[model samples]
Target: MIRIVILLVTLVIGSVANINAQSKYEQGMGKAFALWTENKPFEASNVFERIAEVESEEWLPHYYIAMINALNSFGVTDKEKLTLQLEKAKKHIEEAELISPNNPEIIIIKATINTAWIAYDGATYGMTLSMKNAELYKKAFELAPDNPRVVLSKAEWDMGSARYFGQSIEPYCKDIERSLELFATFKAESTMHPSWGKDRAKEVLKQCKG
Candidate 1:
């Protein structure tokens, strides 16, 4: 009887410890996200890196780190700086991929990174990375067609391609509408999982004709 009581007490203590650990992780990630939302990319990235150090088994922190790098690379006038930044992002992405192979989120972010390079200098990267980016987007769709982020990303890329060639953007506008619909009812696997791209979709929708 005493042994059983001791065992029960140990289990309760372990459970409480787990709860406290999870609470700490949530707090850290929440602060990181707030910083990111506030335009403090460096601070947010630092916090995410720290969290990743502690949450070695979790892929979210690495994902956010890569995402920050990818987003920051945008509009960078210095090609060399952009290359270095994206290279770091690729390292974080590799870490995340190791933890969660073939993840839709990871795949989409890889495509985003490639897109950043293409946007920076299409003449240099388009021939090499364009095909890979398209493949990554296609694979992400196949893996998680219901994922709003994937839908938004793929549709947005198509819209950009259409506008580049003076083609109609009407077709991809419908896909963006579909992404918005998915976002409306989408449920993330956890609070830590991604739930972005809704606002991006809304902004893109502004370009669509009524």
Candidate 2:
């Protein structure tokens, strides 16, 4: 009877341990995603670091960390600071790719990291990185063609690239027209989409003007 009781108790403890572990993993993933989606990268990075430690096999944490690092790199105008963050982002992104090579989101994120470099290089090297930026944005667009957010972001990047490449003077006006057209298209499509509505679209349009 004691043996039977001991065995049952062990089983219950094992089950409880498994549930706790799964709960921790899920909570970590959820927090990481929430922080990232909210654009709170510093907070997201902290959560992602915890997730990475807890679930090394899951690539999302590494991917988010890479994205945050890339954004931070772009936020700075200092070349050395930008390069250091870019390298860090590259490392994390490479690890994520290793974990999930075929993941579409990972591909887009890899392209995002490249965009930061493109922006930085543009500041330092004139138009040298403009083509590179266009190429990465195109790759991202191809990778996630159906995602409304991705489509909108790609169009915006193209508009920036057009200006950076000095194609903005068509006589000057044509580039502006194209940029406005793309922005309008994105605004309409993103706003009307069932999942994402008009408010964010209006904010984006306001940004375009300013």
TM-score of predicted model 2? 0.60
The prediction achieving the highest lDDT against the true structure is 1
After TM-score superposition, the amount by which residue 14's alpha carbon in candidate 2 deviates from its true location, in angstroms, is: 36
Q: Model 2: per-residue lDDT, tens digit, 17-104?
A: 2222246766665665555455465686788777787787878668767866775665577878878777878888888888877555
Error of 2 at 148 (Å): 1.5
Lowest lDDT 10-mer window, candidate 2? 189-198
Mind giving the per-residue lDDT tens digits that candidate 1 earns over 1-210? 223223322322222222222578888887776676555766888998999999999998898888778877877879789888899899999999999999999998898788888878899898788889889989999999999889988998788778878999998988999999998998877666777667667877988964
Instruction: Tell me each candidate's RMSD, in Å, in order.
Output: 12.9, 15.3
- Candidate 1 displacement at residue 142 in angstroms: 0.4
Candidate 2: regions farther than 4 A off: 1-22, 30-40, 123-129, 166-201, 206-210
Model 2 clash pairs are 169-172
Local distance difference test scores for all models: 0.79, 0.55
